[model samples]
Target: MADSSPSLDPVELGAYFDLIEVTSLLRHAVEQQLREAGELSYVQFQLLARLGDAPSGSHRMTDLADGVVYSRSGLTYQAGLLEKAGLVIRTPSPDDERSTTVTITEAGRERLAAVLPGHIEVVKGLLFEPLSRDDVTALAGLLAPVREHMRATPPRSAAPRRRGKVS
Candidate 1:
């Protein structure tokens, strides 16, 4: 006996494919510009920007990780790289020895300031420049619900586990 199931419509699948392709293209464009300017990766730029925007240019590492989309271990690794580059420094939190505080160095601030204008221009060109004011407002409105839903949902655990043999 043979089994059959309905296949996904090509048109519907193409929409999802287009979405991924467009997002990848935009990321690639931005990354290329950033690389031309310097060695900063998107994640590094984001982390520095976060610290730069914080009060006193400092934040707890955990809070920084939470605000950004990186895993805790990933954040630590990146922070280590930033520290090695002398763009950031880590200090033991006065209130908690277990927690470390990260601060943007003068070098970090200068680097971010230099890169920011170009980054903004690229963002405007790739994303906002094409949109009218009303279109930008509408796009922001459309994304709000999804952002809220994501914030409301807690993240899952990242624990490692052994895989078992399947029957």
Candidate 2:
């Protein structure tokens, strides 16, 4: 359990709560759009979109998971789904035989192309419609460093299983 003592000042703590709420709202909205448009989950769409956008149209599985903020194990599942759909293929990594690579297929590209317009619209509506130019810039500037730092650590969902009992 967290200590009762507050680590941040009241205003800062409130801001954190606000950020969490806003993020959830935005995520829910995007999920709806994705589900309706292509029956895709956010992570699945993220994988396809990233692969589609990759210069080489492929990325190592671990790299893809990190980039998309998914756990490595979860990414494996999503990748499997994409492969089964004929949207992508998982194969031996040319750079390292021990690792796998995910490459977007024509079908994957087509799927991404199909969903992108709706995705962009949803983003603009939920995230950009109210923000002024300066608001957008300032928000990005404020968040970018924190995002970069967190990117160094894999998310809990994707972290390797820990060998320990819960308290």
lDDT of each prediction vs. the true structure? 0.85, 0.89
Clashing pairs in 1: none
In terms of TM-score, how similar is model 1 to the real structure?
A: 0.81
Residue-wise C-alpha lDDT for candidate 2, range 3-63, written one tens digit per residue: 8984898999999999999999999999999889887899999998888888999999988
RMSD of each: 4.1, 3.7
lDDT of 1 by residue, 101-152 (tens): 9999999999889888888888899889889999999988977997788977
- Point out where model 2 deviates above 4 Å: 1-6, 152-167
Give the Cα error of residue 154 in candidate 1, in Å: 2.2
lDDT of 1: 0.85
TM-score list, all predictions: 0.81, 0.87
- Which stretches of candidate 1 lie above 4 Å from their native place? 1-18, 155-167
